[model samples]
Target: MDIVLGLQWGDEGKGKFIDLISENYDITARFNGGANAGHSIERNGKRITLKMIPSGIFMKEVQNVIGTGTVLDPVSFKKEILNLQLFDHTIQPEKNIIISKKAHLVMPTHKLLDIFMEENPEYTTIGTTKNGIAQAYSNKILRQNLRVGDIWSPDFQSRAQHILYRDYKMLEDGGMIVLPALEEISKEFFDAVDFLKKFTCTETEIYLNNALSKGKRILAEGSQATMLDIDHGTYPYVTSSSTTAAGACSGLGISPKKMGEIYGIAKAYCTRVGNGAFPTELLDEFGDDLRMKGNEFGSNTGRPRRIGWLDLPALKYAVMINGVTQLVLTKADVLNGVKSVAVCTHYELEDGSLETVSGTLSENIRPVLKWMNGWSADFVNMKSGSELPEELKEFLSFLEAALEIPVTYLSTGPGREQILKMK
Candidate 1:
């Protein structure tokens, strides 16, 4: 069985939930996104940021794999592995994890392009992390990218020289001054490639499929949310890759028949990173409280996130795309002290029309909110759905009713033990 999520924005506490569920699965594979994803898991009272690595890596029995559709930031990935090694000595390339050889490598020039694009003040900013994810994917689609397998080829140096010359010429043509060659760039790139070779697998599709035929359970994890999907999300502000459930199949090389359960994850409220149209966003003191209480900041970029109330149009739209079988609501406790809360049940469009949640309507309309009394109760150390405050239960019930999905999992805090399996 494969469990997939991300009904809301990127930081839906996916890492903690995936870590909690990893014990039941034989393999955990991350399908999409790049190092720009910030999945933080708290275990043994310690918090770790997992970018390229799967959040399930901390499990002793779980085998983690990075799928081909994901763009590789080898330097960041190497540092993450080394950081994990600091806590446990048993993690090694040959024993626990694997990387797809087909994954495109992120070059230094990609980072430069990312920075240049984000720093252009005249253009509308998409609030990127400047992590070179867009540039890496762009090169891949342009068919000018270098993959993991190319690092060991005899022509690697020549290929590098050719790529550098092309990139430098393009920058010069754009009237931008280029920096001098630094040895650190080559050293980091080569070192990352060498490190990745230890775990590169050419036939990830065959490996995963064969394992599935044996009835081995698998978990397909997504990095960003459906609202950030490039083709389906709000235009000019979405991520570079697909962030929906269908992406799970294309990203992991899995068949639709192999997909067992789809879990859509959302917070009790909503939060988004970068610049975009947020219909239900709160700009008052209440929004400030949600930001501070939830520690709502980008895990990868450390940028402050935009806080808002629940948008049902967005949630229902995600449900339709992912075919969500179950819902996992995170940070419900963050709304504990509020006097009242709001959920956007419908949208008021610019054309004076009322529409249900659709991607196009979301871009053109403003939300129509429904208010409810807030729940004031402490959820810390609480372990079960029965123990939850009555008001909190009411909130979840409303969410289920509005989205027509069951709420099976609830997360109160960042720690592993904080999750409650309600269903």
Candidate 2:
């Protein structure tokens, strides 16, 4: 069974949940995103940040694959592998991990383009990680992209040179100033190409399908949240890929029939990393407290996140798109000290019309919240359903009542064993 999530924002504690459930699955695959993703997992009392690789790689018998839809950042990926090796020599990635040959390469030129685009003060900035995701995908769409398979080709150097020269010429034609020597860019490109050769696999799609055919369970992991989906999310400020469940099929080349058990991960409150429309965002002490308590920061960019009250309308919209069958709420422990909590039940438009929270409505409207009693007891050490505070239970019941989705898993802390299965 495949569990999919991202009910609220991107930092939905998916890594810990995926790791916990990974023991039941044979294969775990990350279908999208690049270094822009920061999936944090706590295992054996240690916190780990997973970027390119699936968070389930820590599982003993599970195999992890980076699907074709991902953009490979060789530098960041290599560092992560080395960091993991420091903890366990037995975790030889070459034996269990595979990278798709069809994945787009995040070249230095891509980074350059990302910076260039963000430098334009007149254009509304999307607050990207500047990791080059947009430019790399742009190259792919423009048909000038270099894939993992192309790295080992005999003509790889010549092709890279030609492409680099063309890109530089295009930049010059656009009246944009260029930096760094052409030769230097070419050298760095070849070096990155060589470094990525060891991780490339040509038949990721075929292998994933074969595993499914053999009745092996697979997990389709998404990086960002539904609100960041390029097509469905807030426009002009969203990510470059499809972060919804439909993306799982396109990203991993799998049939929709093969997917099962959609699980949406969200937080007790809401938070967003970049610039976009946020209806329930708190700009005062309440927001500051949530940020400090939750340690709300972008795992990928290290930027402080914008915190806010829970937005049920947005959560319902996300659940509808991903067909979330179960909900997992994380960082509930962070709300322990608050006396009261507010959840955005609906939106009030500029024209004073009430509407459900959505990309369009959220972008231009304000939120109307429903207040609830907050739980003050510590839940970090609680392992069973009976140990939960009554107020916490009431909060969960409120969420279920509002969204009409069952809350099955609740995470109180950042440890692997910190989750309480409620259903």
Candidate 3:
């Protein structure tokens, strides 16, 4: 009944928060996105980076479901579930997870399309993860994609072959000579398709509603963040899915009336990956320092993230769009040991006029900042908000008041036990 999602671009430590609070829910489901999402979670001193799998997989009691709105890559998903044992969580796929029958599969040719797109800089590039996400989603929109349930159909092989042929032809149109060998790629693709055929698949909309009638607690997890939403975000620089709360209804097929609190996860600072108009970007030594301290690297691609001061206007916009009920601050202690910190209070427009952020931002706008004192305390021995440094508390209080939301959860470290709740 509860929802957890990111408010920024991505990598707001949402997976960490989901894993930390997943015990409260009986069912945890991922609504949108695919392998492009990299949720890095630390458990028992080991880091586990999940691509297609839900973050709640670490909890033995939780039933994780990948909802129909996802564009799944079956082979990578199978490997992820099979490799969980190496991380000390031996997940029984049939019991621990289920895939929605309506979910579309990421074909091998989708990767080829993605490769073709990313390789061609002549077209506008969103700096995609190149995990075939856009290509897969495009096929779904065009009704040319294959669903997970199609694997069980009698004519699946023919259907897939036809789709592959169309994709190959599309690649040729895109000016590629050496086409992908159908026999070679389909070998692994068909085997994985068989695995998916045997995997548990269901009509999750009915399944979720039925469980809700029985008083089950459901937690819907979102991929990317609000700012990455295709419709509501920075135009060509955004992801190819609905990452906002609206995504929960579309992706999971759950009604908004059944929803509980929406928890928006954000870092103390802000970050973005790839190219975009970042109004508050710190392009100096401070930016580099923050990146080094937070280890701001893309979880999926290992590409360095663009770090910036926390933009209140952007966060406020996200909260407004998502109808976020509460806020969870992650990496609060990353600001520790710093001498000063800056927050974006307003944006200066091209006319030398200051305005609260609105509309699509451009590189011409500049952020007006408010500087604050930083805390040097490590917070390792601290167990509660009362033990937090006074400076840190004041800074958080300022943010809460400005954003008009309570900061309930604070993540001090990467480990599971390093988090504390305000309540």
Number of the top-ranking candidate, with TM-score as the measure: 3
For model 2, state the Cα shift of residue 356 in Å: 2.9
Pairs clashing within candidate 2 = none
Off by over 4 Å in 1: 121-123, 172-182, 361-364
TM-score of 2: 0.95
Q: Local distance difference test, per candidate?
A: 0.82, 0.83, 0.87
Q: Write the per-residue lDDT of candidate 3 for residues 1-423, one digit (tens) a residue.
A: 889989988999988899988998999999999999999989778898898888888889999999988989987886776677677746676677888999888988888888788789787877888888898899899987889888888999999989888888888887887454777778888887777766679998889889999999999999999888989888889998899898988899989888889999999999999988888888899889889889999998999999988988889889989889899998878888888898998888889998765547788988999999999786787788998888899999998988888999899987888888986
lDDT of 1 at 66: 86
> Which one wins by TM-score: 1 or 3?
3
Per-residue CA lDDT of model 1 for 1-423, tens digit only, reads 576778777799888889889889999988888898989887677777888888788788888888888998878878878888886677664577877777788877677677777776756788888888998898999999997667778998779767766775676676656564535666676787678777756657777888898988889889988888978887778888988878888888888877888988899899999888888888998798789999998888888889999988889999998899999999888888888888988888787888677675345677888888888766786878999878788889988888888999999877788888999
Better of 2 and 3 by TM-score: 3
TM-score of each: 0.96, 0.95, 0.97
Rank candidates, TM-score, best first.
3, 1, 2
- Across 1-423, the per-residue lDDT of candidate 2 in tens digits comes to 475668766898888899899888898989888988888887677777888889888886889989898898765676778888886678878778888889888876777678777877755688999988988888888998888877778997788778778878877776678888778877766765666666548678998998888989999899888988888887778888889888888889998887788999999989998888888899998789789878998887789999989887788899888888899999888888788888898898889988764656345778898888888766666779778888889999988987788999999887788889998
Q: How well does candidate 3 match the true structure in TM-score terms?
A: 0.97
